[model samples]
Target: MDNHDLVALSERRQHQVDGVLTAFFRESHYRAKALGTPYATLWETLERNATGGKRFRPRMVMAAYEALGGEEPERAAYVGAAFELLHTALIVHDDVIDRDFMRRGGLNVSGSYRDIATTAGIPLPVAEHRGMSVAIIAGDLALFNAYRLIDRSGVEGALRTRLHDILDEAMFVSAAGELLDVDFALRQRPPSVDEVVEMERLKTAGYSFEGPLRAGAVLALASAEAEEALAGFGRNIGIAYQIVDDLLGVFGDERDTGKTTVGDLREGKSTVLFAHAVGTPEWAEVSDWFGSPELSVEQAQRIREVLEAAGSRRFAEALARDFANRAWESLTSEALPDAVREEFRPVVASVLGRVR
Candidate 1:
């Protein structure tokens, strides 16, 4: 398939997924009204947060299913919707953990509640707590709905069972990764490159890419070998994707990336880039600035310069490219149909050019 065909296919898949999401939210809003005022409000907040993302996870499911010869677009839509809901839940929870008020340059789920409470004249501490509480419950509801969507997807009972098992494992692994991430941040010292990469693989890779792709393969009744190949591809590419994210956090323009650029440095995230920079000569000049609440854009730029001079930026970019290449090789290991392979080729181009 050519670029135009790929773009057209993506648009169609996006429309179908949106249709499923709209129907789900409409029904959820109706059901929530009977519960209470808070329930209704929370449901509305979820609907809003769910509306904005690129819906990348859902597209992953569709691509994998189609590549594996799954013919029913409606069936793929159901699976895509389930994965998208799962993505929504995780991001909501992640925002709470990160204490981030904005996503894609707009108020996030917790941020919305926080803003509402603060606007009502609640004290800062109390308002923040209340917002966090609402967000926690909102995330929980999203997760529950994700599983519900899959359960009602009308696939064979046996297939659904396998999919659930895959999802359950992914969630469990992701929770552990989240725990490790929190610990890594709280530690006195930065993590090693291997430690950071392991955390990323468990956290973002499993749920964001690996799980969705594998779930689609299961829906298509793909062989074990195909699933294995896709799993490897997903994990490696997901890591590369996260590395790109880390790069963007420090260097990308907020206008283009649609999020603040200094968050990672302020959070003192132990990315592979950080690991690469630690112990270098440049570390002494800026080690104290990371994790500082008072971090300035100027200081951020200085640190970016240090990271660049220390070769960390090149290190990370090279690592991402290497993984992208490996992911392509892994994808080709399976006898994926040619058309499917062609569809996936764009993923390499997209990932490689993400920060360019």
Candidate 2:
């Protein structure tokens, strides 16, 4: 186990993804090849967008599998790559909707096309609209490819139906949660912490933890009891993870997190800390900033101070620890297999240690 090469393992798996993407693009129609700049170019864009990142979701799957005493690392890598594809598909669609021009210091799909059109002297609005349409199609295609990859994984049988159900449910719940999140942003009053937490659980945990890791363990023939236990653990940890993500979105250094501080402020995101700040009378001024297009970074900084004064940051951090502790409890339980427990624990540490 000590000799296992994690970097080499990652590259070999990435190569597998590259080969699959290459074959898919090569079979494309002539017009698509022309527009996508040799189909390989489009795949390369997705690959580029996916670069220099933590592979947390996939690693969670592997950890759960290893905890179940499974040893098929290559097969687990395929499971992970499929998830990365799914995640990138979500990112493509999300960036288009947000009109976000850059991600990871590179032009996002819509942004690149918009730039190209504008450089060619087209009107900015026309360029952006066309670029958005193209991005939407690209995102849809990526999602379709994700499903295809999962189907071709040869992970079949009674558990196959269960996996299918899990995926379907995750999609439905996440979409509903996302819709609610959009609605919350538009509301005069932000959502309560409980409501936001529920949304985070459905939108984040289902896909990020419950479904993928369970699929990995299922692939390894893990018992139903073990799978259920993992799901419980994952759900708690995922909520904590998303809450931390909210904190990072609002407070992390852009150079470190690959995003600007208080990005949630610009969007007026209805996160837990946002709720706490607004609810406190001492920080009640925060309500005035919600949905205020006139709000500036200077004002947001001051409001974040109010949040700090209200102990929201500390509150959120404590909550994060609570959820993480719960996951640790489950991971160490007798319900989990004996041989795989120690390896799985590191995954929790990895999740908790992420800077971004």
Candidate 3:
């Protein structure tokens, strides 16, 4: 399909997926209302949090399914919604872990709750605890609902089993990746660039890219060869996506990205840039500010300057391009239908082109 047609197709598929999600959230809100005020509030916050995303995961599922000649668009839309729920689950948990209170340029679930508590005269520490507890519950609900959506998606027998396996592996590998990220932050020694890359692959790629693509391919009953080829392409592109994300975390505008650029620096995130900056003279100059909670704007700018001077930014950009190249190469595999390959070209381009 041409670019115009592709954009139209994506919009239609996304609309289908959005319909499923809207119904899911509506049902959830009623269920929560039947329980209590707190439950209703939680569901309401989660519903809000789930909206306003790029909805990229659902789009990926639809793209792969249609490209591989899947017949059931509605069923695919349900599965696509499942992946978007998974994205919500992971990010809600990630915000708690990262101590972030904002998402999509506004107060997140935890932040909203925390604010409510403080406004009601609750102690700061207690309010923070309450917020985190509510966020944890929200994340768990999202995760469980993701599985529930898939189970009810009307795919039977082996196909259903394979889809669950894909979800299982995605969660499993992602948990390991999260642990590595936390561990790297606490450890005195910084991780190697290779280790950081692997961490990014496990944390972001498995679920965000590979699992979604492979799940769609499997749902379509694509051959094993074709499935693996698409999965590989996803892995490469996902890694590139995360690397650029890290770059944006440090360098992009908060207004545009809807996130604080200095959060990674203050959190001392062991990103690829940090790995490259280790042992560099420029990094040493601003190393003291790396993880300080009181890290100021001036300090952040200085660190950015040092990172630029150290060529860490350059290294990360090159690494991202390299992975994008690998993704493009994966599309060339004979196992992938030409239509499937063509569908993903702009996807790879978007990854390379994303500023946020």
Candidate 4:
């Protein structure tokens, strides 16, 4: 299909997934209401946090399923919705870990609850703890609903089993990756660039790209060869995506990305950029400000300047481009149908040029 047709197709698939999500949230809200007002409010907060984004995971699923000639668009959408829920689950938990209160330029689950508590005259420490507790339950609910969506999807027998397995692998590997990330940040010794890259792959790549693509292929009943090729493509592209995310976290416009550019710096995230900058004269100059919870905007800008001067920014950009190129190469595999290649061509382009 041409670019215009591809865009239209993606829109249609996204619409289908959105409809499924709306129904899922509606049903979940009612179920929670049966429990109590507080339970219902939690579901409402989750719904607010979950909806509205690029909906990229669902799009990835539909892309592979349709490209490989899967017959059931509706069923595929259910599977796609499952992945989106998983994404929400991970991010909600991640925000608690990062001590973040904002997402997409608005109050997140924890932030929302924390504000409500403070508004009611609760103590700061108690309010913060209450917010974190609510967010943890919210994340758990999202995670559970992710699996429930897949099980309720009309797919049966081995297909369903395989789908569950793929989701299981995503959750398992992602947990390991999150642990690695926390470990890296806490350790006195800095992580190597290669180790940072590996951490990115495990944290974001598995679920965000590979699992979605592979799930689509399985839904389509594509050959093992085709599945493996698509998995490689997803992995490379996912790594590249996360690297760009790191860059964006440090330098991109907050208005465009709907996130703070300095959160990573404040948290002392062990990214590839940090790995390259560690031990440099420039880093030593501003190292004291790197992980300060009270980090200022001026301090962040100074750090950004130092990173740019030290070529850490250029290094990360180059690494991202390298991975994007590898993702393109993965498309050349004969196992992938020509239509599949065409579908992903724009995905690579978007990853390389994305501003948010």
Candidate 3 has its poorest 10 consecutive residues by lDDT at 347-356
Ranking by lDDT: 4, 3, 1, 2
Give per-residue CA lDDT, model 1, range 224-313, as digits (tens): 888888887888889889888888888888888877778888888889899999969988899999878789989988999999999999
Which regions of candidate 3 deviate over 4 angstroms?
A: 354-356
Q: Write the per-residue lDDT of candidate 2 for residues 1-356, one digit (tens) a residue.
A: 34265456545555655555445454543436667564556555555665435666667666666558777655665566566666767678878867777776678878887897899999999999877876787777667766555566666777567656666666677777777777776776668888888888876677888877787777778888888888878888788788888888877778877887755787677788887777777676766775465778888888778878898877877777778778878777677876555555655675566522
Question: Alpha-carbon error at 49 in model 1, in Å?
Answer: 0.9
Pairs of residues at least 3 apart in sequence or in different chains that clash in candidate 1:
none
CA displacement after TM-score superposition, residue 313 of candidate 2 (Å): 1.4
What are the runs in model 4 whose C-alpha is more than 4 Å off?
354-356
Candidate 3 or 1, higher lDDT: 3
Off by over 4 Å in 2: 1-43, 50-52, 290-295, 350-356
Model 4 lDDT tens row, 211-293: 99999999999999999999999999999999999999998888887788888899888899999998577789888899888
Once fitted onto the true fold, the runs of candidate 1 whose alpha carbons sit more than 4 angstroms away are 354-356
Model 3: per-residue Cα lDDT over 1-356, one tens digit each: 77799878888998999999999999999988999988998998998999879898888888899899998888888888999999899999999998788887788888988899999999988998888889999999999999788876888888899998998899899999999888887888889999999999998889999999999999999999999999999999999999999999999878878888888898888899999998688888999999888999999999999999999998999999999989999899999899997899987887778632
Whole-model lDDT per candidate: 0.85, 0.71, 0.90, 0.90
